[model samples]
Target: MSGAKSVSPENRTVIGLTFGNSNSSIAYTVDDKAEVIANEDGDRQIPTILSYVDGDEYYGQQAKAFLIRNPNNTVAYFRDFLGKDFEHIDPTHNHASAHPKDVDGAVSFTIKDKAEEDAEPSTVSVSEVATRYLRRLVGSASDYLGKKVTSAVITVPTNFNDKQKAALLAAANAADLEVLQLISEPVAAALAYDARPEAQVEDKIVVVAELGGTRSDVAVIASRQGMYTVLATAHDYEFNGVALDKILMDHFAKEFLKRNPSAKDPRENARGLAKLKFEAEATKRALSIGANASFSVESLSDGIDFASTINRLRYETLSRTVFEGINRLVESVIKKAGLDVLDVDEVILSGGTAHTPRIASNFSNIFPQTTRILAPSTNPYAINPSELGARGAALQASLIQDYEADDIDQSTHAAVTTVAHISNAIGVVSLNAAGEEIFVPVVPAETAVPAKRTVHVAAPKDGGDVLVKFVEGNTHIKVTKPEPKPKEDKTAKVEDAADSDEESDFSDDDEEEEEKREKVWKIGNTLAEAAIRNVKKGGKVEVTVQVNADLSVILTTREVGAQGGVRGQLNA
Candidate 1:
């Protein structure tokens, strides 16, 4: 977890926490900026794990290391089991660690405080485990902030039931953390993207794709004004980071077996399998940023040392189907929301698994060229996918920290679409994105009213007097087929064979073209207009639009680096 630094807690302020099955993060916001806090170990993405060894407790990344060495005494993958009964909880994810058992119809884990053979196992409820984890998380935040953090807006998956949320709240209370708000993960992701410096608060349908270590989840949301409504969601457990890691493990294991024919497979050996898995996971992460990564494991199987190297191309080739699976998951979730691919305006990739370039490229192929795909691997301005939720929660915490709890509840539960809105989109008529004279919306249609938005547009290249016009308008797609290219004369062959060899150079650029999409802004009735004169060359012009509930428009215009110019009000 990380961001542009702006914060510290004073007098027990609220923080933001994102507790996932595989990892957890903490963040705080100040001056409208959120910064993720690291634990004492200097780890931002702390693993959601706890371990017991020799009667001592460990948490976070430190605890993750003992999962293999003290498997039976370590607890993991219990986040989803909170407030869930034995019948509803799945134990497959905990097979490598402490196995959860049904105790009095409630899900619990039996783990020992010590790794000794004679140490008796104690039954720990999932709630208590979560409480302990939360306690540690708060402690870490306190140490960093130099003050106690007693409250937080923790994020949860959309599928979280009322009982689960209540259970989480109770756990947080036991851990000395007040539950400020339990926001949905996808909405939090959208909030984070909106808070970026260059991001425009446009109305769009966004798909938040979260590919975790154990599972993958995708949510389709409608973002209007400053509100986000989740339209649909889908979850898949079979395709995830672990599946990709297994592909690499299987590939390298085959190589090991070939080198030592008599050795047993690493999968059949417990110690060797652990070593192989650890190395394979590391290799997968390494290949995400670099073109090549090497895998090394000592005494992997039957006491045989294994060493191998795989390029990103080979690794991605082997995991092509896995990337395609993730892309398909996004597409399926969007369709589940009763919309096609074209309706999606933006896609935000969340979780550490999204670091893979192949996954982003696969999504780019599925989405239209106009669709903005946000990921560290795809968008230059996108934040780390792993920290999006936490940062969003922190920003939310900053937004409502001082409000009354009841008022916060009522405001959050209220539907944003219920508010009165203008009859048409109140926007500015100017140069469109393509330099075509058209209307560009600052505050889009269906925006909840009494709304105000500020936008900066390019003044004329050699600036002078800038007339900014406010119009009530909407955008419609304009489809146009390009004129056929001049047909190449295939019959006229090059006389020299060497000249024909040079023809291959242009082959890469000879891709088949198709129908193109152009966004055309359809101008409507003008509301008002204002002029700002004497703008510097290449300077930006600032225009502010405020659409009130009475269908009135207030326009403010000024050159960015100059004194204020003019303001006007017009009625519909």
Candidate 2:
């Protein structure tokens, strides 16, 4: 409440907020790049956690340390319960803390202010918890910026419903932050990789996978004419980086048990289990960077110290099933968009879990050779995945922070506008090196009318006249498998089994057929056709398409640098 302020175009100071379920990050841009701000304790990746000691507030990593010693007073993992009833929410992750309970029909936690045995605990609603966390976050940003933060663009998950957004907005408002916009986590990641709406970027498809501490989300997006459309998405709450940490914890727990036959299971003891969890997470982070890491905990269980070491390969082997499952999740999301492995042009990995090299290698194995992976394990130039969401939101805030509030609201409000949108993509049909029909989209589907898009079409390799046909297109994958090598005759079954050469050839061919499943693009209905003649070799054609609010379409075509372009209108 102390930091609340009014924003004007001249005095606006905007920041980005990524309110993740497990961790939250804040960022701001001074030039072209967004820098994630570190708190006074020097943590860019701050834990979304809070603790109470004698009514004093503790936050971020500092609060996280209290989980082991003062679990009863610490609050963690409360982001997912916002805007939901106590009866409908799950509290599995809250067992180590002051667990969520129904208080006046709302999700709330009872936290004791002091360690005194008879002290009464206070009931705090989930919304209040979120508001307190946001206040601290925004206050930190203000201290770092040397100015009062006026507005922010926050990132949320795609699965967040309308009620959740409203609740988050209310919490932000209570924290003295003006809500500029609420962006999707995947879309924010995409923007961090330079997918700006005003840039004239080529059309392509991208898969954004965010494997977080508590959940995993994969999205299939189409980037057409500088506009992005989220075609499909998938989410999993049970699988993520926590699962990997549990594996390491269990490994050391079992080792401790084997070494000390007289002691009970460390997991059965709350403090011992907490130590294992903390060390396991540290070891997991260590393994992300080096070939080998050591796990050590002092006075782990039953007055015994536990120490162990694990190599990267050993860790990978233990977590191989998780890697495989993540790959399957990625594959299923792509397919849900009616696409194949080859159709994805780029794969952007986000979140802390994506730092694992094994996960990057798993992604490499599933996507095609041409697909570019923007992860530290694959691309040396890629941004840190953990900071992508916040950075994107910051970039967006910087771009629109100078605009008038009324104008910004009008552009993003769906109910306030009378504009219509096209339901399908419009593109040109061309021939590739093999003379196969290739549809080059200029206007993507769901573009609001009246809309306009421009693209340059290349001439034939030898530089001849080009004929381009404008068509309305719907994406459909046509699978093509090579003809299988003729099967061995039944009479030669025994001979073939004994002949190693024939068996090797058959196996090789069969594997090739099974693995080379190509997703070929097929041409859709033609809407208009235009031909440019007398173009010199190495010449290029410029094509522009525009759709009016009345659903009428107009197309213009001409050779680059040539006068008097051709223009035609058609009623659809």
Candidate that would win on TM-score? 2
TM-score of each: 0.75, 0.86
* Candidate 2 structure quality by residue, lDDT tens digits, 1-572: 12323366787889998988789999999766788999889999999999998778999999999989989889998898989888889888888787998987799988886667687888889999999999999999999999988799898888888888888888888888887777888878988887343434766788999999888999887765545667789998766898899999999899999999988899998999888988999999999999999999988988899899999989988887777778878999988877777878899999999999988877776776799998998988788999999998998888778876665665653311223667677889878889888888888765656778889988786776678799987666555665655676645644654563433321322234343556544568888898888777888888999998798999999989999778899886
Writing each residue's lDDT as its tens digit, candidate 1 over 248-358 gives: 999999988888899999988666776777799999999999999999988887777889999998998788777767877887887786666776899999888988887
Clashing pairs in 2: none
State in Å the error of residue 245, model 1: 1.4
Worst 10 residues of 1 by lDDT: 1-10
Residue pairs clashing in model 1 are none
Against the true structure, candidate 2 reaches a TM-score of 0.86
lDDT of each: 0.80, 0.83
